[model samples]
Target: MHELAIAQSIVALAEQQAQNRHAAAIEEVELEIGVLAGVDVKALDFAMKSSVKGTLMENARIVRHDIAGEGRCGDCANVFPVNRLFENCPACGSYAVNILKGKELRMKSIVMATIGLQP
Candidate 1:
């Protein structure tokens, strides 16, 4: 599934970042996903659970932020909320609309594990 690939990429990114900073592990990771991004959250969650084995994000708390769809009507210049891309403008019922948001899938932040010297 594509979600597995996505999960793999996410884990790889976290590992790369942790390696760069020399962190022992990843504490947390925040992801921003838009409604219009065509991503299945359940599948991604399952994939991530299986993919993070022995990785830097194995114990990290993953947070997901769902972004609402927003679009502007080209005919009336009115902005409105949408759940899908095929939605027409609410103000003028125009099909010519430009999406202002809700097409994103990316990592927002990552919290690295602190390495302390304990004797």
Candidate 2:
């Protein structure tokens, strides 16, 4: 699954960040996942857990923020909630819709453990 690759990438990034800060370990990782991002959350979670083994983030807490999908009608300028891509506009029933949100898969923040610091 691509989730495994994604997880590995995330781990690498976290490790890089921790090393850059001279951290002893990673304490937490905050992620933002959008509904329309096409990533399976459960699978990604499992992949992340597996990927962190023996890594700096092995004991880190993983926090995920699920962002809801939203879109704006290109024809009528109406904003509405969307579940998937290429959705027809609810107000004008047009296929020309511009996505306003919910296409994100990014790391929002990371908490690292400094040397001799109790977290």
Q: Quick one: best TM-score, which candidate?
A: 2
Clash count of each predicted structure: 0, 0
> For model 2, what is the C-alpha lDDT against the true structure?
0.95
lDDT per residue as tens, model 2, 1-119: 98899999999999999999999999999999999999999999999989999999999999999999999998999999999999999878999999989999999999998997656
Candidate 2: list runs displaced more than 4 Å: 116-119
Give the alpha-carbon lDDT of every model.
0.94, 0.95
lDDT of 1 by residue, 1-119 (tens): 89899999999999999999989999999999999988899999999999999998999999999999999999999999989979999888899999998999999999998687576
Task: Specify the highest-lDDT model's number.
Answer: 2
**Using alpha carbons, what is the TM-score of model 1?**
0.94
> Candidate 2 clash total?
0
Candidate 1 stretches with Cα past 4 Å from truth are 116-119
